[model samples]
Target: MMKKFGFTLAEVLITLGIVGVIAAMTIPTFVTNSQNKANAAKLASTISNIENAFGIMMVQEGANTLDETEFYQYLTNKDLEKAESTFGEYLKLQGNGTVTNFYGEDKPFKYIGYSAVPENITLSESIDVYQTKNGALLMFADGFNEITEDVAKKYGISVTKQYFLLRIDVNGKENPNIIGRDVFVFALCEDGALYPFGGKTSSVIQTGNPTSRHYKNSSGSYACIDGKFSAGCTARLIENNFVVDY
Candidate 1:
């Protein structure tokens, strides 16, 4: 009979060492990739729901314009009762999900810049602060602001309705709420369309360019890019197919 011999102890130990080294090198990368993918999915889902809400509102309301008040009525009507306070009347929410409000001493959100750096931002209590059922925190505020003639042309669009901004934290109550990281910003135009930070006009539709008039990707910083919202990283995130740059 042919003699069969097991590998020596030294060979086994060497093989195990190599395996351990490979695992050590690749495990963190695998984890990071998995987490990033999860965050991206959450962001995409939130954006889709918001867009669908607006689309449905347009179909039902038979109108093309939306104020902050009207938009939430269609967007987050179901969770109206759960909020601490609202600026305008809410009629119905497109989905039957819960939205909890947080303001005052209980506020659980923070601000950040496009470079995924934290910032000092004192949020006015007048704004609405709420967390969606999908674990997204929405910092919403709406009002009309004047735009200079030069600014309008530079943004590649004519003046529109009262400006409404939405800053979203894809994973509510999670750490690293930095914009361009877990959080992103968006603008709901009076025309009833949702645009990313860098103006969704004919000239620039989600251009991640750092020099965009609406807002550009911050270099080693995260400052509110749009004249209205902070960080302006959403435009770049969208341009990058919803991938967050570390």
Candidate 2:
């Protein structure tokens, strides 16, 4: 009697079809969420590694502030090679070279479809690139504000500090080469602090106060908005405890 109560072939097929439809609808979203979490973790790890290395370097050099360290000296002198080499020494790097050398054949990074880019500079330019042992790419560039001032002014923002901008590609040469996703930016300040690009204000830096999570624009109609320049996304991510919600 129990066997006779079982569903007919058509009913079973219909049930299976509905299940398949549900799976199809949900699987991609699940996969995307998992990937986002993984990227966020990777980015947080890289940031921790960098801060630790900077701390260790300062301790080893008997320097209390980053500006006193030789690494900062190299950066101030615009000696990117020495800056990269010295900082690279502090961290565990697999290799260092031009962007093309490291990002070969990978799809060039986009701004998550947000048209505004840094200083209108090419994202895939031949910048100094370093790959960590964990496979994150660290790209260093100088004149953070001067280079990005035009775009900053467009949004009623200005970062008039002597800082170097660091671009981190959390997953080196990997897919989803999108800013605010796989790519983030940080500012190496003259005060020897590393800050998310849009974190500290000009007044805060001027006052010698410690940087805080006061990102001026991390939401809609401001910086880090989905369809806007994403330079502030780093600060946004940090504000969210490294969660990749946006």
Candidate 3:
């Protein structure tokens, strides 16, 4: 008789209801956390791929030093056609998919927000943009500074020395495309390989130059905070191997 003792039907139902409530409260948080982790991994993989490719090409060309313009001559063109030829034809990649020298699409990219867009221009509208199969975005203009050649001349800089910007939309045009959260700026120096905008954060890159200036802004919060943009976190996350710490 004692062994038959158990909770009544009403008590069991109450217990189940409490369990459901707890799940409802926690599931969304868990889902978000999981997605963030996966996105972080994607960011790491994507940037690493680009960096490695650049290194291999440089070594093959036997180049010890290359300015931005020379790098493009060694790598891509105005339309990055050579990039497609090597990375696509030979490497069997989607050629990282070519993009035009135009801004947003006749179909705008679904996720148009930029967490850390530069102080210089419009996020999606001002730059020529391209998207890759891995969900990363390549944004560059004809010259530097602005999307026109005049700007480069005004700055006395060529397109090669000015460098290009990368916005990695972890989900690729998906919703909640907040910059820094879903996107980060991976800036490639005109003369150096790709590194997060705030390059000093990378131990490997900043190794001997403790006093060297990599990024002017030093905000390192994972999410764009205090009105700070996502670009600030690029070097931070890159140095951390693309694992964003909350």
Candidate 4:
């Protein structure tokens, strides 16, 4: 014989089994890492698109002052429905594109997606808008209806006011359905900055006060309170500073 260069059948089987075990252990880890990377990329891309839209609106308006209504109308007129759809598709979330009393929808005025909903929470709108000193529109929201101390502990970050920003203009000289009283919608946040759950709240309509906005539950209480609604409510800017092309 040729000195038995290869192992016996039993030996080969043992070797193959070891390889399979190793593969099973590492494959899931690799898959999970890949998923996280993809999600992060999608988030960054969505943010960039929104920023670009705002920039365009600002240039058209000739100034960087806008209200929530102006922003919504501008988006609708421009037919930027892709922004919301892209987000939902990438996140594997189902949303309606119509304005409704609930939070998550696929409406042209609502950016709906899944977030960390708390226990015993009802559906509600949690939108906020702000105007920056540098002519930028800042919007923010809480991904969850309420960030309880226990939940905050689980995330390893203190439950703060989560939010996002959309810098645009609303002078109305550029488009119709634009131009409105500049409103600064503020929310009560004792924790920290508002968390913007990507473009999930982009298509939502502006409920509550346009000046000082607060999320309310089905019972008409602040949606940020624990035990009021589910924990997965996402905070976002339904509409921000944006000018329309009149």
Global CA lDDT computed for model 2:
0.69
Superposed model 1: Cα runs more than 4 Å off: 1-4, 62-64, 68-119, 122-126, 142-144, 148-155, 158-162, 198-230, 243-246
Q: What's the TM for model 3?
A: 0.63
State in Å the error of residue 142, model 3. 6.6
Q: Rank by lDDT, descending?
A: 2, 1, 3, 4
TM per prediction: 0.63, 0.75, 0.63, 0.38
- Residue-level lDDT of model 1, residues 1-246, one tens digit each, is 999989999999999999999999999888867766787788888778766666665666676555434445634343443432332222222222222334223333444432322243445454555555666776666544444546556766654433566777778757655555576766666655556665344114223222543444343233344223444556666777877664
Per-residue lDDT of 150-243 in model 2, one digit per residue for the tens? 5445445444454666889988988777778888877765444566755655324423322332345444322666566565677778879988
Better of 2 and 3 by lDDT: 2
Give the per-residue lDDT digits (tens) of candidate 3, residues 1-246: 367778999999999999999999999998877877787887777666766666665566665533423446634354455545544421224333323233223332322243333445444343444455665565543333222445344434333233455556666666555555566665454444554654542212222222233433444322323445445556666667667663
Location of the lowest summed lDDT over 10 successive residues in candidate 3: 202-211
Q: What is the lDDT of residue 55 in candidate 1?
A: 63
Ranking by TM-score: 2, 3, 1, 4
Model 4 stretches astray by more than 4 angstroms? 73-116, 120-246
- Top-scoring candidate (lDDT): 2
Clashes in predicted model 1: 7
Q: What root-mean-square deviation over C-alphas does model 4 reach?
A: 15.9
RMSD for each of the candidates: 6.5, 6.0, 7.8, 15.9
lDDT agreement with native, every candidate: 0.55, 0.69, 0.51, 0.32
